[model samples]
Target: MGKSPSVGVLHEDDCDEVKFFEKPRKNLQSDDENVDGRPGWLPDGWIMEVYCDDDGTIYRYYICPLSGTTFTTKSEVLDYLFSEMDQCFLESKNHAVGSNLTRTHEWLPKGWLVEIRAGGDNMDKMYKFYVYPPNRVRLFSKDDVLIYIKEMKISGFDTDGQCNTNTQENILAILEFNPEGLPQGWVKEVVFRKTNTGKIRRDRHYTDPIKNYVFHTKRSAALYVETGKVTIRAFVQKTSVHEMYSFEKFTHLHESLWKRLELGGTNQLRTRLSKLRKLSLKEEILSDEQGSTSAEDCNSDNSDTAHGAGQNKVSHLASTTVKRPRGRPPKQGNARK
Candidate 1:
């Protein structure tokens, strides 16, 4: 059997060095937090803290902008990150691929952050980052845009209707930043305008002094800002023609319109309206064709009489009439006698 190798003896200084190398630096105050040695920077509206456990698990806790608090393990954070920074990295892998694209919004677990260049001549004045899903950051003017650069899912824009909880998590984020942040208006007017649009009815009779309209309907309806006033048009059609008022002219046709609007007017109510208008135009065309056809038939009959067929029929009718008028006079004379 081979003899075991002799173990080397270590000095006190060597022992100290071995112990120091084995011991991790307890950075209670330093920026480096995790295994990746990434420095942590917490944004103004967020709260970041570490959770450590004996089983070698470390969790990063985030206060969600909406619900107030959120937490994920370090492994989970790594899973969600898109990029690796000096001290921190993105949770998703595809984040770096879309760094050059604009209007590309990133989806975080709790909310989303979209980087936007403010509109017009002053391009560099400031780039705006709008956060959503839970929109925790209430940004002041002077903050660095990169402070909130966390991992986000780079998905499409939010073109759907106004979001409630039912909307997709990422979609809600983009919708929150539409028009590069909500337009400057009262919340009421903005919502009202959004909900109304093509759903509102237009008054065809009056071209001048256009009137404003306000309206609503069951389940699905539209309201609009028109003629400096709000107009609403609702309709649902299945069988018998029925229409309802923009404000009060409720009827069969209106119900049909509303129903059609609800089922089909997801993002393009105008397209739906265009289809309906086309149908109306088609009906008008059919009516005009029938009228013209009838007029042409009548004219043809009249002209035929002037030529031969009508005259021949008239002659035959006269021959069959014989002396009916004279026979009536003779019969009356016989009765008198």
Candidate 2:
């Protein structure tokens, strides 16, 4: 038996010497979903480098051949790459010694290998690369490829919260962090006005500016963002906001609860909890205050009535027997007389 080929191992047929990928590259047709899942526009031949903030917002710079400088915002580039193509997928980052690399993202595909670049500035600072259809794209580079694939295989990204901008109540729920001292809930929600603009549009309006959410102890939480503000519904549990902000933590919890779920951690758990709160009213039910009533007590009370009825039936039968003897003797005596 032969061992599997190592990372970036190229085959003769797989090599594409073309410096640029032909736009609308022949639709990727394959028998397998993983092979076919990627877009035809994504027929390999791109170099990639991934970076992230301490807070966990990810950025990928690609050496893609495609040309268009109009994309002013990061969201615009991502929207076109991941959402538009459906062929792109993200690569995972390698971990340092004793460092537990956490999978916080739900967007990228599973079982993807991590490959890093050699010392660029610092040996520690290497770009993460994951190649899709490993058998398909040929890696032919000791030299750097100029154009790169910025992002890929995105499942979800946030758009701005659509709160009524005019209202002071601030329909948008804002989540902010105070690293100096943690708040009571370890998170706080306050009403404030924010400017809404065309910079990043999810639909016609609204943008979910990615924000930081951290938990101090598994219990205490923190949220921080440098440029934009996030508005969340007030009373949105600190845990809920915490889950949203800390993608890595959220993914860990998700995997622990339901291992059957796919490679990415579930947003399902968060969605289910949200729907539960929304469906229920704020009013307290009196039954809740009554406290623990056992099934034994209920069964005993119901059994008592049945026991009383059985006793009454026995007494009535006994009286009928006694009366029958007396009535029979009188009837015989009266007939003889």
Candidate 3:
């Protein structure tokens, strides 16, 4: 008979160290008992075979039942199992979506589930929404949900074809930040602006009371408060005098204020404004210097005028007292006659 290939024996080059062992027996019992009569945490049908070297060093190899693949560590087996579970979950979600079995949210694509659960502790009667995507990953916030949806679209996983404009609007409506939930002294502001394409885009801003900075998103506000650094896009605007009024009045502030509220909420506006102030200061200084120079010239002119007047008076006295020749002396011939 031809020689049969041995199983569960890894090549020496495959691992850092080489180990030799006796052929493992077939039909092993439970995973725990199969591991040299020791308790193991491996799932059913997984085999943990022990090996030894001449130096009395021990090595363990794990075998996957379904694929007959060999692994050197328990973590590898667990990772394989998790990957298998994810595949299975994905298939199930696809099936559910095709059959219209899963509950759908107006905002989310079909096959995605949204669960509303009553909040615990201080939340009391409040309810929180938890989203479950087709991948079975639980999402807790609107930002996370949006990110997941974006990734799905990028990966071509939009099975229901419901990730349309209306669905997006519904999602935004549901996930919109509630101004009433803001902390004391913190405000939420929304500014509607037209893009270069003339599409109306709504920008949401959150104020951090502790840092006194305005962030474009709540996550950014929290991050700034935690790190003491503005890690995201932020804007600086003059505190409005109309802040005490109602929201409508605040929104209706001067048109110039709206212009200041545009995007690029980083140091761009700040640096630009600073440069303007510096230019204005320079102009003012130059004007002051010019004024001082003109004043000095005027004073010198007045001094010169006074001095000339005194000289004129002296000259007038000389002209009246000393009868000096008013005209050139008579010609020499005329004098002789």
Candidate 4:
């Protein structure tokens, strides 16, 4: 029997390697002879090259004329063809009207419908793509289509609100539990905010039920839960009579909680009061240190002034007093005689 054709022996070659073989200039037209040595199956504009190595093993490679790229297997060629078809479909949809615009192609499966629609105002134009399955259910976006297909595969039923299997998992059930080995009563909450530009932003908050504390980020919450200490950084704005200064201040977690607690949460009234008391104690300690420094400076200045005043008094007395002569005796009666 003849040796079976080796499917795995085909490999793509570089431009330098293609220079070694003399390529056919004329295109093959008849179905009797085709590229890859397979009659009546090869695509147009694609040429095949066959070669033998020193070990006598045969290799076949397919080259694309449009892209000048090489493919080693039939699957690669099929993938390129389908991708080109999709590109053409998208180009056609771009010029289509804003109505239903449903289309079906020979390449698509039976009863599958694709639709493209242009929406939004003139200032903000957007295109929305949708797909309808054989069951006539509409799926929006590629992700929705993928999810629908996945559900069909897993449950083997049309997902028209009749599938008994629980396909959609609860995200909070996965996130609320402590995944990062956080403390036992801590729960995670996700907050989504939309900006003025219609963009969505997600923020994570971890809540500690035991201490009634809510941390904005995971790292900070983890640090406090594990170590009982955290550093909070905030931008402080100080306004004076003539100018305003903005500076960043880093304080201990407990001290900053007072300001944050004031923003909301009437249920945390006791917690806020306790945090305020702790904050006041810290401020008192800082004020005491500043007072002691100023007192020491004042004492030093007072002592220097007192010493200079004493020296001036001595100099003034010396200048005003009369100086005694070298002979020592100076009485009133001796002077008269």
For model 4, residues 1-337, the per-residue Cα lDDT tens digits are 9999877533465655565453342122222343336533448767888775796455667886533557777787777676673343233234222111111121223334333221222212212223353565544344565666667522122323321123211111112323244533344545334334434445565654333356777787666643455447311223210111011111122222233223323346557888999999999999999999999999999989998998999999999999877886789898999
Ranking by TM-score: 3, 1, 4, 2
lDDT of 2 by residue, 33-141 (tens): 2321433333375444455468644444545433212333345555556543222111101211111222232233332322222112212121223333444321212
Q: Say which prediction, candidate 1 or candidate 3, comes out ahead on lDDT.
A: 3
Query: What order do you get sorting by lDDT, best first?
Result: 3, 4, 1, 2
Q: TM-score each candidate.
A: 0.22, 0.16, 0.23, 0.20
Q: Which candidate is the best by TM-score?
A: 3
Q: What tens-digit string does per-residue lDDT give for candidate 1 at 243-324?
A: 1111110112222223333422345767778899999999999999999999999999988777797678889999898564
What is residue 65's positional error in candidate 3, in angstroms? Answer: 51
**Residue 264 lDDT (model 1):** 27
Best by lDDT: 3
Poorly placed runs, candidate 1 (over 4 Å): 1-112, 115-128, 132-135, 138-279, 282-290, 293-300, 303-337
lDDT of each: 0.34, 0.32, 0.49, 0.45
Error of 1 at 215 (Å): 42
